[model samples]
Target: MTTASWLAIAMATIVSAALAQEGQTQSEEIEELEEIVVSASRIELKASEVGSAVTVITAEEIERRGDRYVSDILRDVPGLAVNRTGSFGAFTQIRIRGAEANQTLVVIDGVEVNNPAAGSEFDFGSLLVDNIERIEVLRGSQSALWGSDAIGGVINIITKKGQKGFRGFASASAGSFATHDLNAGFSGGGERYRFAFDASRFSTNGISHADEDDGNPENDGHTISQGNVSFGVTPIENLDIDFTGRYTRSFLETDGSIFNVSSLTDLDNDATVYQRYGRANVAYDLFGGAWSHRASVAVSDVDSKNRSNNATSFTSEGDKLKLDYETTYRFETESIPDAEHAATLLLEHEKDTIQTSSMANEVDIKTNSIAGEYNLSLFDDLHLSLSGRFDDSDNFEDEMTYRVTAAYNLRETGTRFHSSYGTGVKNPSLTELFGFTGTFVGNPDLEPEKSKSWDFGVEQGFFEDRLVVDLTYFNSRVTNLITGSGNTAVNLSGTSPAQGIEVSADAEVLDNLNLIASYTYTNAETADGTEQVRRPRHIASLNVNYRFLEDRANVNLGIDYNGDQKDTRFSPTFARSIVGLDSYTLVNVNATYDIHENVQLFARGENLLNEDYEEVFGYGTPGVSGFAGVRVDF
Candidate 1:
């Protein structure tokens, strides 16, 4: 039988099976608040109880999608825009709520991974799906808890942990453009000690980063290898210690620069990048579990080298170290017998250093922070949270930020109402304050950017909690906006404002079918009414998934639509010009079927429609492509 026929039959069988238990399942609807989350509050709390806009991508979803890069998975998220220069291993940038790429904080296993030498922007291209367990995208100003580079939001990646019994998996795939992916991992644990290790290698004879029409015909290729290792120990009950380490190396052929702007013209340049991250954490419980304390130390390092056939070479390196301590206490009061109060205190210190080949000396920056949070739960239906942070740094002025949030659950109506207001501050990046000459001159007297943001949202659940609708409105105003004008970096006197609305829905419309849809509208511009470059005003996505054969087979189809936007193009003759980039749509599909208890076959088709699009002007994008693979578990 054909693959389509087989899928139909399998789906029918699973649907029948699901129908048999539908009555019972519908009667026992679980509360949405029971979904555990950590990033929204820096502590464990139910999703419905948190007042922030957050999206969680669990490992199960990651595996089902079979994404090659983290950006591929993040594209479907609401209130975020992901852009890439071209095919595999290209530079990827994600803007949250229309914030600049450098304003978002990226945390991998509790370590900040932003490159200090690159304006504190973390390249999404460097991150691969190897040993990740979950990803939390928390939207809005998080500087109240995470310090600088958090004016936009935070992307927290949590890696996998060892299981109780020994388990391992291996997977391999090959596709168009001479692409290949190989991955393997194993995890095991005893009563006291546990360990997990994973490794992956991906390579593609990629398309040129620059458009062929832009006089770039030579093909650009990329190769990357990554590994992760984690260990944990439980010395005694209520006490745990953990350590995680990760490394990635990438080499790619890139086009030359136009007007000193990389990835614009074909120059036959080669670039290599290396990233390393390590973190250690310890947690303890005291006073009969009423009080909890945790401590952590983390370090991240990044190095990059670029060379051209013209006998020119450049190197840049960044290193950072972080220390953190936190304590939480829970108590009850007689005045509110049904209420509980939890208070947390946090202290953090960080040191960052950056060096470049042309720089005479390395730049070092230090920052320290103290923060506190108070949460109150009344009658298990209303929640209130307040947090504040104070930061002291040597590079910019000192600042204090705070956040206040409230959430209420209407059990009878199955609705949740939430609202939040917060303040954010971003210090000048090392490259903006003390960068090398020739490329762009740094402004030592630049002031820090400050922001005030607020958001209100409502979530409604229906059909025995099988369907959920969410809507949120957010707004932010940032002063001391920083931009580069003709090789000179300066802060604009006017403010930058971003306002947006997000709407999303999740539905299990059928016994074995699921649907997810989202839409976002963003108006991001300068105070003087200038539209931001490459910030799309409208974006939407729809995803459908079906499972069959008693959950042994499944298929997922996704469509994403990106709206038109403005971009800047550079050329020696034209100097610089503003251009309008047309909007485009992309469709992707993936499927998997179990052949044996421990083995499965999978296939994927990307850009099925082959629509030509450009996230950045003069950059090439991938066309329709297909891949098939097998995975084995033991």
Candidate 2:
């Protein structure tokens, strides 16, 4: 109590223990910078070095979850599931865990756009959102590096190349029943030379039901027209070139959704569709050596019609093609000395073509591929991933897939774990190998539906970095899984496997409030025991947000829950056209206000607690809907 006040309390206890050990080494360096990840092992490894389970949706959370297709921005991302039927963008479906929709594998800006005559799957309502800037979801089973629907995972959509300047904007919206008009374009000399153009004309007199004004059931009324163009060039400065074009046209009406989707006892129906997509790219980067290169190409087309109400009418068409190439090599030494090493190698080639035209029937098909991958890390938080692929088809022959991943982190309790195994192949669709109704029969010695999946996960985080958590568990097996007997639509009967569990979370919890959550569980049956129908054995999501002005104003809210399913073709020959779906919850709200400095004002509402579900099965959605817009920046 007196040697000069105990030397000033021992210099304040050694400066509070060196500021709590430099704040825990900057909170373990921001949790190793949020476990920096790269779409699950396509090289650029990290997500704890990839075992599996990778989810990222940037572009400012897809503009605050406003949704504009990328499968409605992955319906709140968490084991994913999106099923919408009719709303201008009718019949949109994206299934992850229960694995359908061709087992899911979509990539844009990195090519491989799926839908090769409906084999790999990609119609995410004709993908559009002006110009996607980020998306990376690598759930479980990536077919060893993306070879055929990855068996319920792998989606990459990255777009936005106009480095800095030469702005563009235009948007419009009308409510009560949907109406949209938009325009956009970009002009050269910014990143050397760049160009982009977009167009839209949406329509809807939709959603009001309460059955009968044909369009066939649930809400009714619709129309759509869309267009897109993208171009880029940097001729010098490391050379780069890009191109994109797209189109869509639609019109529909189906009796208030077939009398709320299969009840109005005697309602009527009608439909339409047309889609097209094209893309190209070339890139080269060689900063003082170690090699770098990339190349790409893609094309897709679809045509459709189905005018019925008993008057009868039908038509269909399809086409697709894809190719890609890559090369990367980077090396830095001292691997065993002072730890630091980076290495990577990747190679690929792909192709596809499919055709179908039917007033009843017509078919054509093709798919070919070859691939390879390699990765390594030695300080970027320990990582290793490898991949291999080979596929050949003209009716199947030659198949193989390989994968490996390892990640480790404890760098003082940032806590992480990873595991993965993949192999998938799903081929057969031209309406299941050349289709035709009123006497179902189509099968050209069908054989294709091999699958194997795996996943293991763990994640944790805390404050100096706004809480985050991730938990995962997954299992899969397909083994020639396709079913049909008595009329054969591409015969296949036996294997059907599925099992799952998932939980995801995110929290900034107030700097401006942020919270996101997810939960999913599934067990798909079918050993002829049926129960793979509308796939829902539980699903949930919640999101909340608030951020004012300086952050450029914001307000957001969302909630979705689903459960209740059964109707695997309800027997007795489509049992009066199977129907049974119930259990739903939906609510959404949004607002953004900048209103100045470049202008911004937004408003949104979807279902806003209007409930009354149905993702298909008697159709019903769109109860309180809304839209308001304004966005300008130059």
lDDT tens readout by residue for model 1, 546-588: 8999999999998888888888877665456778998888889
- The list of candidate 1 runs beyond 4 A from truth reads 1-33, 258-263, 310-312, 573-575
The residue ranges of model 2 lying beyond 4 angstroms of the native Cα positions read 1-49, 56-70, 75-87, 90-120, 126-136, 139-141, 149-175, 178-220, 223-304, 307-314, 317-392, 395-401, 413-465, 468-506, 510-512, 515-634
Please, what is the TM-score per model?
0.94, 0.31
TM-score winner:
1
Best by lDDT: 1
Whole-model lDDT per candidate: 0.86, 0.66
Local error of candidate 1 at 369, Å?
1.1
Candidate 2 residue lDDT tens string, 287-332: 7545678777777776767766656565555666667676767666
